[model samples]
Target: KGCTWRTVSVDKIVTRDCHSKVFGDIVQATQPPACLDACGSQKTNTSSSCWVDCFYKAAAGPDSGKPGGKVAGMSFAELTAAWEHPFLPEDQGGCPPVKPKPPWFAHTTSVEQKM
Candidate 1:
């Protein structure tokens, strides 16, 4: 019961925030439907869409006939408009900086002598 209530509360908060003008505008500015569709088509796993992949492909600049080229059926202008938000300066609303990977530690294998 408590878990269900907490889930409902979180959902309501998210829905409310998403419906707000500021958040809605940001989402619309960043992820247009066409861009999402294009990325969805390219996904290896069709069950779910990858927003990160869509953002990268959409921000790939002009069409160059490459695998990750501009989305099909979408003009350069349209792509650019949809891609505007992701390219914004960090202070404005751009992607956060990537964290460095942790150092790798090798595991030691012990050899057992025959009894």
Candidate 2:
């Protein structure tokens, strides 16, 4: 009953500590509000993928080099782009913000102010 409602595989997303500062900040900012909910049975693990999906939107591109710098091996633009495919939304998709939000979700502006 937690964010790990879906257990995290460190190798997949990489440990949070391994993220570059700029990338880390982006991950924190765009995290889906659904992520804070208590764990339960669900058809999909949108709680976690929702966040990774959001990250992919911004990080999957030829120019994604900046964030991938410290995270990935060498410069492999097209290959990297192919690897981080964007998650398409289906049945409301993984893109929409959750209603009422999960507990303690921070307002974007508030988070920006703190940054």
The number of the candidate with the highest lDDT is 1
TM-score of each: 0.22, 0.20
Q: In candidate 1, which residue ranges exceed 4 Å CA deviation? A: 1-74, 100-115
Error of 2 at 67 (Å): 23
* Residue-by-residue lDDT tens digits, candidate 1, 6-114: 3232111122222232332443344456755655555433234464444444344335346666544345675554445344445765443344334353343345432
Q: Please identify model 2 stretches exceeding 4 Å from their true place.
A: 1-22, 26-47, 61-115
Model 2 clashing residue pairs (backbone): 1-39, 2-39, 89-93, 90-93
Please list the C-alpha lDDT of all candidates, in the order they appear.
Answer: 0.42, 0.37
> Across residues 1-115, which tens digit of lDDT does each residue of candidate 2 receive?
5554663532223222322333333333443435323323431243465444434434443244465434432235643432332222323222222233334655345756778
lDDT of 2: 0.37
Residue 30, model 2, lDDT? 41
Clashing residue pairs in candidate 1, if any? none
List per-candidate RMSD values in Å.
16.6, 18.9
